[model samples]
Target: MSTDPTRLSRLPIVQAPMAGAGGPALAAAVTGAGGLGFLAAGYRSADALAADIAELRALIGAAPFGVNVFMPHHTATPAEQERLRRYARSLARAATRYGGTVGTPAPGAERDDWDAKLALLLAHPVPVVGFTFGLPDAAAIAALKAAGTLTVATVTSPAEARLAADLGVDALCVQGAEAGGHQGTFDNPDDPAPYGLLTLLALIAPETDLPLIAAGGIMTGRQIEAVRIAGASAAQLGTAFLRCPESVASAAHKAALADPAFEHSVLTRAFSGRWARGLRNGFVARHEAEVPGVYPYVHHLVSPIRKAAAERGEPDGLALWAGQGWRLARAEPAADVITRLVDEMAAARKAHA
Candidate 1:
């Protein structure tokens, strides 16, 4: 678990923390390979997150791994609340497909349990910690550093990179608009302007000396080498690993990546309220227009539906999160994926050199 950015450059492979999809086995397999693996702590309870950390620690035997946390944000407005209510009512039809009712939106109490998670991490630290959605407070950052955790912030723009750097994060996971799942944008805009990974890396590289972990639509060794040349120390891939045997991504999700009927990925807030990339489906088509820009509220509203869909092995209603490069994903072992990536990266580097 070296802190040197150069070490990251040497390995240059990081698995993105995919909530629901990524678990200890996937993280362990990725870490067991040369690259770093991260456990997603976004939707899990604090106790569940702790159990994951302990399990990962056991499997890896003190190897450096990461846990990604979602930062808290401002609650939705009155107008947004009204929209949420409407949206919840609309989901009633979908809920019946799963034999469950639509979830009630508790906007007042919608949260990820940030404090309890922070306390959990502080008391029992892991090797690495990353944050998405927003930057944690300075004190929290300082506390993590003091506890010997390497902090990384997921940023989607040069401005966001600057903010994370100013907050003293050791690295920036520059999440391009092509990224799957959530945008990691601080504000969670209604319609975010797209930023390509290479463009973001070029823009932020000149502004700060922090190591950049390039994410979004990266699924190959050539892409990894490309990011390295663009000034990123490493490449973090989530969609690429979703198909791996160790990944906990639903069978439907893994199948959807290669499914001909599921033509492409689209950024929709229908499932979670926040803009996230997933395969276009009947659910998105029906509900995308009705979703409000409220987070965990929308997330809660749709949870029951997603669970029912998963139980039924239905892809249409599940959040089949995938990046732009979904077509390039493979069904394989996690170690094999890393091996192929590293070999490909080496070839790309040599050819370019």
Candidate 2:
């Protein structure tokens, strides 16, 4: 535990930067409770992300927290582009079923404003910055380091871990296949075979000197202790905190986490082009096979339908991203969640010792 990030206040617990679920309130609450917190910058514009950074700073002062951004994605080929168009047409039908319409798939609309967001982060440096989907250029990494920001990369394989280490990232968030939301693989393979969390940690730990933060299906204090024993400096959890009162996860999402009808989580590309873990629902069951591996385009294509589903309080149409251990999630204050985790972690460590 001596390798814990100096910026971390006390515990080695880190709240995952969950887009659409975590925000300033949740991040601040987690930080206030003696753990590192993070804000997801994936879906926000440069100005919107900046506003969040400003608000978090006002709320927590100089306390250490992190911001995560989805790296600029790869360009699609002609065949893949055609698939995107065809996929959009099918989604149009799906949208109509929900009494909604789908968004137009513009050629270059998948861009996440990566350049401006990077510029904003450089101008207003934060305690930590994490990247997923792809690696940042070496120069950008250098600039962030020079600005006194620690960098973390989310990697699903040892090859990706070595690549991030070569780029001078200070830490690696080792995401397992069980992770909620999108798998942080650099390339969206036609078929993915991801390592389980413990298996991934074992493979990546000996490959690099950089700290490892284990993520995926971690919902209990014993799980946290287990990851630490496997050589992780900390544990990052997203699904575990989804039901917290401060979390911005929708009522439907919160409810589905605890709902008996959900049964189990599955990896599906129906919501977005990228593979992600979420509760199996009618939408996923119907469209998983038809989904292309085309990222933000597919993501944008389903935006309107998802919005309509949210407005109608329908769980089936929304992406109910959750980890395997989602059944253990508790709806409580974020601080209490942290405290319970700490207490449970302590008990686990003692019992195992």
- TM-score on alpha carbons, each prediction: 0.96, 0.97
Q: lDDT: which candidate is best?
A: 2
Q: Runs in model 2 with CA error above 4 Å?
A: 1-7
Candidate 1 lDDT over residue span 1-353, tens digit each: 56743264237788899999999999999889878889999988899999999898899896778889998867778888898889988999999976767887553445588889999999998778899988988999999999988899999888888899999999989999889888888887876796998898889999988888999999999998888889998899999999999999888889989889998789999999889999999999999998888888999889889988988889989998999999999999999999999889889988978
Tens-place lDDT digits, model 2, residues 248-298: 988988999989999979998898899899999999988899889889888
Which pairs of residues collide in model 2?
none
- Please report, as a residue range, the 10-residue window in candidate 2 with the lowest summed lDDT: 1-10
Model 2: how far residue 220 lies from native, Å: 0.9
Measure candidate 1: CA RMSD.
1.5
Instruction: Provide the lDDT at 131 for model 2.
Output: 95
Give lDDT for model 1: 0.88
Name the weakest run of 10 consecutive residues (lDDT summed) in model 1: 1-10
TM-score of model number 2 = 0.97
